[model samples]
Target: MNTRELETVWAPRMLSVLRIVTALIFLAHGSQKLLGFPASDGMPDPFTMGWIAGVLELFGGALLVAGLFTRPVAFVLSGQMAVAYFIAHLPQSFFPALNGGDAAILYCFVFLYLVFAGPGPWSVDATRRQRSA
Candidate 1:
């Protein structure tokens, strides 16, 4: 149809797709660190910051996938990404590419955007809003 109609109808659905895909990718990072399913160099010790990050990535990614409490979850994840970038990546070099912190920066902004966007359509949050109305 028209561009306006396409945007109106597809954008929210695309947001859901984005959320799901991002969560899956993010979860894999956690799985690598915590579960070691895909196998990594090493697993982080329990309760260490690395392990803690793994916990957040695994659980937070799941929550985002489900779009449950999307705003709050996204807020925490955004903060985590920001902290990760500064703590792990900033020291190596000024440029994100050199430091390999580009993903962190992208995740930070994307999660921050989700904090405002409210997970869009096809989300538990949307369903909850619908039922409550």
Candidate 2:
């Protein structure tokens, strides 16, 4: 394939890959917190802000994994990441590395990007849109 054509075909696929991988990782975070499948700091008590955030991560991460309601869900996820960084990370140090906030920072920006870009090919949203047209 020519360079431009290759780029055209690959770009959307890259987005789908990124969305899927990121969602899975985020879901693991949720699972660790809520389900206690993986080791983590600790599970929050029910109805606490931490518990609520874990709930959001589980459901929202699932939606992102499915590429359903990509924009809105990603937007909310992005906001959650931002809040998490500021509240949990920013207090510890000036740099993300010092504060152990790199994941939060990365997730915040990645989800923010997804909010603007929408789900790419291989997504349920894209399939639904295609079917409607």
Candidate 3:
């Protein structure tokens, strides 16, 4: 196939994969907060920070997975990670492996990337565009 045709065909597929992967990661984090799957000591209850994190992760991740308002969702998630890093991780140290700092930094960057790149051509937004055209 020609380069243009290949781009049209594969680009969306690649984006779909990235979206799914990122969504799953977010979902897992939400689940941890909501369900206490990993049994974290910080699981918040009744207007606690953990509860807020759970809600954001669950809803944001769902929206991202569906490719609905992905940029906004990713932007929010990125902010969440930024807060987490500064409040919880950075005071400990800058090294991710030293504490949870690394993970928080990584998540922040991933969310930022999603915010800029968006859900790509395979998303619900893309479908909406197709229908409108």
Candidate 4:
């Protein structure tokens, strides 16, 4: 295929891939926070805000990876990332690099993007949409 044709063919698939990869990384963050793998010194205590974020990250991220309920879940995850950035990083410094809020900020924006973009062609959402149509 030519460049434009190839782009059209692959763009939605690439979005799905991006969503999956992002979700997997978010899930890993949840795992590290909740399961304490890799020996984190700062694992949040149970029932705390950090733990709660971890729970959302775990389950919501799983949903994202699966591309189920993509819009709502992505919206929620976006909010969570916003909250996480404010609570954890904003206090340290204004800049993301200095405050260590870059990941949270990035997640926030990425989730927001997913909220607008939906689940793309390869997702459960897309499959459901097709069935309904």
Candidate 5:
């Protein structure tokens, strides 16, 4: 196919892939903190910032993966990532690399993009729109 055609055909599919993969990775962070499944040092204490972040990451990531309520969920998750970077990483160093917050920064922008992008064409949101129209 031509370049334009390829882009047209694959762009939405790629967006869904991006959403799923990113959510899977983000979910792992929550699992580590909450369930200790990948076995971090230990689970965070209940209702602490770390534990709260884990809760959001776990549930928000799941919602994002399904593309359910994608825009609002992405907004909240994006905000969470931003707060995580500032609170956890910025104090350590000015540079994201040095602070180990590069992933947080990336996730922040990506989720923000999803907020604007409307979960592409492979989401429950998309299906709902299609049905309602």
Candidate 6:
């Protein structure tokens, strides 16, 4: 296949993989908090901060997985992670190496990327656009 054709095929395939993987990870984390599974110290309590995070993760992750409303959902999820970093992770220490701040920071950036770049051409939003056009 020509380079252009290869690009078209590979890009969408990669994006689909990214969408599913990120969504699953987010869903698992959110479910753990929502269901109170494993019972970690950092896990948020229901009807509180945990509840908010759980909703964001669960719904946002679902949207991401389906490639629907990806940009807005990713933006919200990014904001949520930023808040979590500042409120929970940052106060502990400046060094992520010492604490668990690095993971939160990483999540923040990843969600931010998704917010700006969106779910790409493999998303449901893209399909909807194609249909409308």
C-alpha lDDT score of every prediction, in listed order: 0.94, 0.93, 0.83, 0.93, 0.93, 0.81
Candidate 5 ranges with C-alpha deviation above 4 Å: none
For residue 24, model 5's alpha carbon misses the true position, in angstroms, by 0.7
Candidate 2 local lDDT, 1-117, one digit each (tens) = 798987899989999999999999999888988998798777999999899889989999999999999999999999999999999999999899899999999999999999998
CA lDDT, candidate 2, residue 102: 99
Colliding residue pairs in candidate 5? none
- lDDT tens string, model 1, 1-133? 8999889999889999988889889988998999997889999999999999999999999999999999999999999999999999999999999999999999999999999888988989999999999
Kindly list the per-residue Cα lDDT of model 4 for residues 1-133, writing each as its tens digit: 7999768888889999999999999998888899886567778999999899989999999999999999999999999999999988999999999999999999999999999999888889999999999
Q: Write the per-residue lDDT of candidate 6 for residues 49-122, one digit (tens) a residue.
A: 87888888887888888889888888888899889988988788888877687767777888888877778787
lDDT, candidate 6, at 73: 86
Candidate 3's residue-wise lDDT over 1-133, tens digit each? 8999878898768877888788878878887888777666657785787789898988888888889998888888899989998888878876778867776787788888888877888789789878999
The candidate maximizing TM-score is: 1
Which regions of candidate 3 fall more than 4 Å away from where they truly are? 1-8, 38-42
Query: Global lDDT for candidate 1?
Result: 0.94
Best-first order by TM-score = 1, 5, 2, 4, 3, 6
Model 4 pairs whose backbones collide? none
Badly placed stretches (over 4 Å) of model 1 are: none
* Clash-forming residue pairs, model 3: 96-102
Q: Candidate 6: which pairs clash?
A: none
Candidate 3's error at 45, in angstroms?
A: 1.3
Cα lDDT of candidate 5 equals 0.93
Q: What is the lDDT of residue 63 in candidate 1?
A: 93
lDDT of 2 at 36: 87
Model 2: lDDT to the true structure: 0.93
lDDT of candidate 5 at residue 123, scale 0 to 100: 89
**RMSD of every prediction:** 0.7, 1.1, 2.3, 1.3, 0.9, 2.4
